[model samples]
Target chain A: MAYTQPHPRLSVVSNSSHSSVDHLSPTTTSRFSLPSVPSLHSSITTTKPGPNRPNIYDRPLNKTRSAEVSASAFAFLFSEVVQYTQKRVSGINDLERQLNTLGYRLGTRALELMVWRAEGSSKAPKRELKLLSVLMMVHTQVWKAVFGKGADALERSVENPDEYMIIDNDPLIERHISVPRDMSQLSCSSFTAGIVEAVLDGLSFPARVTSHNTPTVQYPNRTTILIKLEKSVLEREELLK
Target chain B: MAIFSLWVINKAGGLVYQRSFADGLAALTSNEYLVLAGTLHGIHAITSRLSPIGSSSGVQVIEGETFKMNILLTVTGTKFVLITSIKDPTADSVLQKVYDIYADAVMKNPFHTPEMPIRSEGFDSRIGTLIGTGQT
Candidate 1:
């Protein structure tokens, strides 16, 4: 309720400042005096004390694109997250599932933020109405925004019409993570798979996404994110076609 | 220019990881390796105390006839010891790189417990490649 309410005091201050500017003559003395009113008003409004800290929504979205966390720092944080998830799980699969759940929450937020960023201040933001277009967007824009590079490949499965894959030669999430001999089946990229699934789900695609370690001799950390669409989605696609 | 071996000791003077690159050095048993780590850790502490200046860092470089040992003690008390050829000038730099790799591969590993023996294949292969490149 507090957040939804517009600041009456702020609007009143701004209105008075605008009216004052109109009354002032276009002289150097007026110009010098003019800044003092707005500056005083701004200083009072901007520097709100204690609990009135600006929320994320209050901040500008178009921040520096080049802003990055050091890879080592991310690795350390991710490692701790994995270890924390591992503590509560019964087995490797359970651990991966928990990690996926953790990523799913992040995915929803990431999708919304990505869409918002793409829309900018445009009155009419374009939406991906088709399946292929949405997948391409994820494979390119979403992947680039999240991992700083586009996925290596996106291909539809030959056997399954509803199945698709997004391949990354070296997924950034698992770059430093090496699965031990006993847990060779465990792919840390399952977290990324969850993110992809959430993105699709957010767009009403209703798909299940999973990550597989499809390593080659050249790229030992190669990962393929497998997406399986629901029957309803496929039927809708056909209807749209 | 040739690196012979590397050893990592945890804060409590336990051998967490050990690897030998060269072939000429006589092989020691696993127990001996642990003992060696503990002995070196003790000597390090003793040497630091022996220093005339107050609160000096312990034995960093131990020079021998055939090989030299360079020790890097991290802020967290983890020790990285590199054994290189007697005349090798890049031992310190190589140790620093090894520390970087250890921080990345071992410390960042989700499966790795703090101060535990590191068994990650990524750490092994990277170190192997690093030492291998250094040899050539």
Candidate 2:
């Protein structure tokens, strides 16, 4: 279920607003209240419609259709996208950044969709409080939704508590992309890193995601996404505990 | 009637891939395959430009006595060519399915570079299975 508890401060402020109105209705002591209900109603109905707009949240995702798409269609579209983005970029880094930005937007929406989907199932969608739980969710649920399979591994840095790694033997986004020798440093998996960053950021876990080429014997395109959490988040995490 | 083979040509008219599903078609040298791909690309480009009706740059079908070739070109110029026995009606759908797999196994593969030859064993085996060939 969605987080239903209102903040303590929010309730205090709303009650004060109701009290101010209550003073005016002292003569009629029936005590009828329409305080927070109207505001909630307005927020729900405020979504405006445009002719070609498709709202992702309006209806439940079609179970069978929502999860899969023609990979060829996606590849062709992604190729054109890379080509289009490439024209304006001065270097490989810039191109990768642009692609990351594209993936970031997708990640934000995907998180919402995934959370919504999770709610429809038996398990209650939990707030990402624990670091391990969040990483597990990303490594399993998020990875599966985006790539059609779970990431191969999730591990914490032995040297640093703030650093985490999500490894995929074969990242799907890099399937067609072969970086040139000159741009060997470039990893198109940055788009996927952007997705990971956005997902963590969505849950207020500020972190940097960098994709590294870790070629294993079995997984040549083996990608390890390093997540470095912000100091503030680590501090807050400690306080929460 | 059955589908026999599939070919993928990049926008530059280079043959990136070619696979034979059935044994009747004549085998050519790898260089010959490249020439065939390049020639087809040139002809397709010229046909689109020379269309009397204008702006229709698509090559839909090419019929031979024994085989029919169906071509599906993406908006970005990647062409999928499927050759089949003349009476096979499912060539278009098969090509479309192959296109989807290409996007997945090759395009999405990080090791695969655009406009480069596909060497991914995953793509090879998937296609092999799809076309009823046990061999990858």
Candidate 3:
């Protein structure tokens, strides 16, 4: 039997006979469906305001907790970054400076993450207050975390009291990068230099850091990251001693 | 197994890089080399279309009486052609290694522009060492 008109409440209750409800006038059904429309719209709008997807800030900061990315992937990405920076800059120095600036941002983030991870560990976190200890932390902890190994050597410059150097026998970033003969002066390790500079800067040890290609007979890709502490920093170090 | 030479053709069928290992090989002028690369690229395309069962990768291994040429076409259309001795069984493996090196050295070098001639000193040295080991 055809029911041309049915109560909205009865139609909702008798969902099994949905085909009969199709015979009802479109205007009547639309009017009845209008009440549920607001609820559906409200639900969608609620989800829109606060998405179920996790934010980056909510993620764990511990390095060990995260999956390690392949070195080749990093190499490919670093290569592209260098190329992108190369196009924007004028001279090799300008390119290095720009790369250094980019690395500085990474260094700040790395420092914060490392500190957080260290605090999360079992051992009581010891604050690095002195210049020597801070340099040691960078040479050991920072290098180990970033490059998977400690720096080869850390030495104070005999000629200059304020100057120090951290030597890396083979810098990871420079492994596949071969600077052309024409631009032999350009060292990609300037990025790492920036990282070291940022770490020092963040720790309130103001210093200028620059990377130089210091190849030897044994190590072809040896890089020396020179750290030149400011006069104020040296004076503070003397007071601490 | 002795590798005679290597040629790199960009996606546009242009000769981008070439290196010769053995001495006493016939030397072609730069212009002649470009023409040779273009001819080989054209031949590969034509042969792929000529396959009986749908399209196939063309002219993979071209064997001469004394030498054999192995062509490796990457997904991006760059071709790495390695010419080795006819008796060499490891030509394909060597070609694979060459491709890996190209991806690392040439592609990774900021100084190297895509589809241009590769003049990377590191690439040259690494390729030399790789092919040199194969020769010995």
Model 2: residues with Cα > 4 Å off, grouped in runs = A1-58, A62-66, B1-136
Candidate 2 accuracy as TM-score:
0.55
Candidate scoring better on lDDT of 1 and 2: 1
A1-241: candidate 2 lDDT, tens digit per residue: 1444557668898999999888867733433365466567667666755445546555448454255877667766776777788778898779878988988999998898788777777576567788778989999989989888899999899999899999998887666565656767877788888899999999889898888888878776788999999999899889989
Candidate 2, residues B8-127: lDDT per residue as tens digits?
999999999998888767888999989988998988988888777858866789999998889899888999898888888788788888887887777765456789887776687678
Q: Score the docking of each candidate (DockQ).
A: 0.65, 0.20, 0.68
RMSD of 3: 7.4
Put down candidate 3 lDDT per residue, B56-125, tens digits, no spaces.
9889999888888899999999999988888888888888998999988888777788999999877887
lDDT of 1 by residue, A1-241 (tens): 6854568777888999988876664554665669987678679877774355666566566774556778778888898899888889899889878888888998998899888877985688899999999999999988987888899999999999999999999989898898888989898988998899899999999988888899999999999999999999999999999
The CA lDDT at A235 in model 1 is: 94
What is the total number of backbone clashes in candidate 2? 9
Model 1 DockQ vs. reference: 0.65
Native interface contact recovery, model 2 = 0.33
**Model 3 DockQ (Cα-based):** 0.68
lDDT of 1 by residue, B4-90 (tens): 889999989999999998764678999999999999999998988997867899999998888888999999899999888888888
Query: For model 3, how does the per-residue alpha-carbon lDDT over A1-241 read when each residue is reduced to its tens digit?
Result: 2464566558666874675566566756785779787678778877664555545676556645445668888988899899999989999999889888988998998888788888898488878999889999999999987888899999999999999999999998888888887788888999999999999999999888888899998888899999999999988878888
Q: Residue A8 CA error for candidate 1 (Å)?
A: 52
Clashing pairs in 2: A72-B100, A174-B109, A174-B110, A175-B108, A175-B109, A175-B110, A176-B107, A176-B109, A178-B113
- DockQ winner: 3
- What local lDDT does model 2 show for residue B6? 87
Q: Is candidate 1 or candidate 3 better by lDDT?
A: 1
